[model samples]
Target: MPDLVAIASPGRRRQIIIRSAASCSPLGGALARAGILVLPAPPPGRREGSPAGEGTTNMGLQPPQGSCRGGVPWGAWGTVCTALCCADGLVYALGGMGPDTAPQAQVRVYEPRQDCWLSLPSMPTPCYGASTFLHGNKIYVLGGRQGKLPVTAFEAFDLEARTWTRHPSLPSRRAFAGCAMAEGSVFSLGGLQQPGPHNFYSRPHFVNTVETFDLEHGSWTKLPRGLRMRDKRADFVVGALGGHIVAVGGLGNQPCPLGSAEGFSLARRRWEVLPTMPTARCSCSSLQAGPRLFVIGGVAQGPSQAVEALCLRDGV
Candidate 1:
């Protein structure tokens, strides 16, 4: 087992001192005893979007001290749980729920050398709780929620052109789905969705669908059912690590947040479960920095201020 150490946090952040494997089980029982809510995922269609069940407050997370990695200036909109990506020598803050709980299309970029944010062209459709991934010089926005309704619009922003263009919208609507670019194509993984009148599922079900959009052919194809994720999860994190697409902690078919994680191998074409996250939480923010994936700010028991990172070298 990897060693668990307590590192002092900067600023107002508390030191997350998970001392030893003996004390901290893979189920994160230690965290649960410490006032962290590790409840299993509630039933589907119970109130939608949030995994906290109905009437439970959304984990409006604040970045822990030193969790933002390259000293990213606080976003102009003061948002939380937003998609922040670093590419082409700049940090991009895309659509996320503003501090006031409203969807925002605001796009801001931070130039490290200049130490300032420059407003870019806003997304054509404003949304919060959306996820963004970069391919080549463009940023793609996937499904997100707006006022309890899922936004199915799929749009991309060209870095050079500074404009948004609509691509093929998702075949079905979903919110808080996980997306990652691999082998020159973009992959949309599982997420929660409510049943639409015309839908095939006919009932709200946690999904394990895997759809890939080929940039070259400009077409979308759903992988076979056998190729779907082993776990039905949403509000998770997806990134390419060790040459494989890995899905981190999120809410699934349980009453509590899932600690289990998995990675998809193109060669093996199977989702292989990895070690569970030391801290089980949903709605956490994940960012790939160097050889590690930083998982920050999500709800475990309640709104969490804990931060943890999975060193990519472990998988490689």
Candidate 2:
């Protein structure tokens, strides 16, 4: 497990302490007894506002933390290949397709501390299967299918500047690709580039190619192959635990999604399969919050809201 460290911003005097494993501190015990933590503020902060302050009337409670856990409510609907972005102390969920049939442009922000969700302006392009990465305060949404065909267009949303700008299109149209932001570049991995609405079990093949776009150079370069399977999504997470970028469950061109999980060694330029997920899924979302990786909604034989946790002890 990685060591816990507290990062404090000099200007705001606010701090965030992350631990590899949840602590059993006094605060944690108190929170567990209460069953809920109440941090009173002005009805939670909005995405388009200044940093919230700690006021006397506003009390923040620290919940009893524990290692990650997983459980799924069977029959739950509304699953899509969504991107999760974390910036400025909040996590923002970007574009995805839901049960509505049409791609969603809606952006939702969640504040874990406040246990609340805030809806923000939708993306200019309503798209599903797109991937998102953060460069400083800006968030970039890359290739995914739009309308009827996979698109290569790219757009970025600046959190600090509060504006959206169009970037150059990807070299090719791809969806369900693995995406990771590292060393100032967004690395996109293999995905399907079908031209029509194909279900998960469709025979569309997965590409083994790896391509990366340099933020500074404004150019894309295809990297050497690391894995040969198709439909395997990349990165699918943020932050590094166990000194690796974890890629979770995805399907190949095979009839069903694969339970296999893998991690990329950025320094080594190699891939290592981790412990397989309890379930096989594709088009799912994986989030790295603190030390655990949460594998959220995705499609198996059908859409699933099944949530699972991947721990370091179980992987490379």
Candidate 3:
């Protein structure tokens, strides 16, 4: 297998597509068999009309074109289970456990125009299974695990300011939870609090809790009902689309991950089921980009690179 890298110039836009061959390596072959396509990096120039003016530029060594998923390559080694978010056309990748099971603290940002990755200051604490979202010009990171230890600490990164600020802790410690931002508030739901590192996967203790933080009020509130209502599933991806908050995929005590997807309508105060994904996965990252919902890189029986795209208009 060739080490591939793709670089985009400061103001250029590129389309990246991943092609998998049957004879390719296990990872590549599996991806191709799954019918997944990685998206190219975001277009350059601060994503036109972004609230944050001319955001930061890419700073890392450029990988070869077509080597990474879509146009963005996983930095250095493939960092699966990492948290990702996009603000002002810049994509930010946060901590995840490496192949060695040790948590990584490196933070990398991608500039779509340049099609390059840049290094940023590391998180104060290393975390995996962390939930992240972007609001205004800031990226908010919430509860995750440090080697099986659930965390309640919350932090925010200011893109324009280029700094991180610690926020009030979550009401309860959690890891592998789903988080999303809507109407200037952050909603977190469904995660696990393992007893110890050795006991992490022994019995998956899932929560059905739902909590929200009002950015403007700087306070937290318990929602009317827990996310599950009765289902005991951990949520993987939480995102906002057209005034609705969607939660997709997670463990449900079944042998396989779930293809179930549900959404909360902020306008209606009700939960509705959307179209199920083609495959079942958990611990994946999801983002809404230009009228499409992209769910990327999750775990089924094992880590998967299956990327599924859904159109919001098709739902209603």
Question: Which number leads on lDDT?
Answer: 1
RMSD of 2: 11.4
Per-residue lDDT of model 1, residues 1-316, tens digit only: 1122222111211212121122223435444444332222232222222223343233343333223233332344355445555565565667777768888888876554543456788888888767677777787887788876778778988988888999887877776688887798888888887677576666666788898889888888989988888889988877777767888888888999877788888767788877788989877655455566657666777766666777655345
RMSD of 1: 11.9
TM-score of each model, in listed order:
0.70, 0.60, 0.66
* Model 2 ranges with Cα > 4 A deviation: 1-84, 89-124, 195-203, 226-241, 301-306, 313-316
Per-residue lDDT value at 288 in model 2: 52
Q: What tens-digit string does per-residue lDDT give for candidate 2 at 1-316?
A: 1111122212221112121211212233332343322222222211223233422322232212221112111111132545555565565666766655677777765455544456566688878667666676688888765655676768888876667887777775666566667677777777765544446565455665667788898888876554433235432332344656566667665678777766666666676667788877765544454466666556778866566778773234
The whole-model C-alpha lDDT of candidate 2 against the native structure comes to: 0.54
Q: How far is 201's C-alpha from truth in model 1 (Å)? A: 11
State model 1's lDDT. Answer: 0.65
| Error in Å for residue 263 of model 1 | 1.2
Q: Over the stretch 232-292, how does candidate 3's per-residue lDDT look in tens digits?
A: 4675666677667777788876788988877777877777778898878875545355456
Better of 1 and 2 by lDDT: 1
Number of backbone collisions per candidate: 11, 1, 9
* Candidate 2 residue pairs in clash (backbone atoms < 3 Å): 178-234
